[model samples]
Target: MGWLLLLAAGCSEIVFAVSLKFNDGFTKLWPSVVTGISGIGSFYLLMLAIRTLPLGTAYAVWTGMGAVGVAVIGVVWFKEPADWVRLASIMFIVVGIVGLKLTHAE
Candidate 1:
């Protein structure tokens, strides 16, 4: 359950981040609203998840997963550059997330 909450929080973070591109630096009203709401919700869920998970592990998983998801969204939806270096860095983030989850018993 805690893991699920953490993953949901990560997804929310990704949603907020990807939506930022459309926000036009908060000049666009609707996207900015969505970004703000989702960002708040993500933080709320992250705090809930941290209640059960170790702080370091929870923070790593949340940020790492969010970064990977947002990067993929940027590449697919926004056509952001998908160079080999960027892809490799994302892969490293995935590896680190997996390692953190595997080693975190609680």
Candidate 2:
């Protein structure tokens, strides 16, 4: 269940991050509002995940996952530059997240 909570937190982080692209610098009303709510919710879930997971490991995985997810979204959905170097960096973030999850002490 702790892992599930952590995953949920990571998802929320991704949502908040991707929504930022649509927020128009917080000018677009609906997307900005959604982004604000999601950002708060992400932080809330992250705090909950920390209750059962080691703070260092959980935070590293959460942020890494969020970064990777947002980078992918930026590339695929927003047509942002996703050159080989950027893709490789995102892959490293995924690897780090996986490694932390596997090695994290319960």
Candidate 3:
């Protein structure tokens, strides 16, 4: 359950991050609203997640998810660079996320 909440939080974090790009420094209307909502939602979910999960592990995984998710979105949706080095770095973060999850005990 905590892991599930963490996952949702991670997804919200991604949305919050992506929305920042469209918010135009909080000048935009809809995008800025989305940014505010998702950012708060992500933090709330993370708080709920930390209630049951280890704080350090949950925080690390949550941040790792946000980083990897935004990087992928940048490459695919924004047509940003998809160079091998960047891809490999993303993979490493993914590996670390997986490692943390696998090692965690309920």
* Top candidate by lDDT: 3
Taking the tens digit of each residue's C-alpha lDDT, what string does model 2 give over 1-106? 7788888888899999888878999999999988998899988888998899999988998898798888888899889997899999998898888999889776
Clashes of each: 0, 0, 0
lDDT of 2: 0.88
In model 2, residue pairs whose N, Cα or C atoms come closer than 3 Å (at least 3 residues apart or on different chains), thus clashing, are none
- Predicted candidate 2, C-alpha RMSD: 1.2
Better of 2 and 3 by lDDT: 3
In candidate 1, stretches whose alpha carbon ends up further than 4 angstroms from where it belongs are none
Q: What is the lDDT of candidate 3?
A: 0.99
User: How high a TM-score does candidate 1 get?
Assistant: 0.93
How do all models score by TM-score? Answer: 0.93, 0.92, 0.99
lDDT score, candidate 3, position 11: 100
Write candidate 3's Cα lDDT for 1-106 as tens digits: 9999999999999999999999999999999999999999999999999999999999999999999999999999999999999999999999999999999997
Best by TM-score: 3
Error of 3 at 41 (Å): 0.2
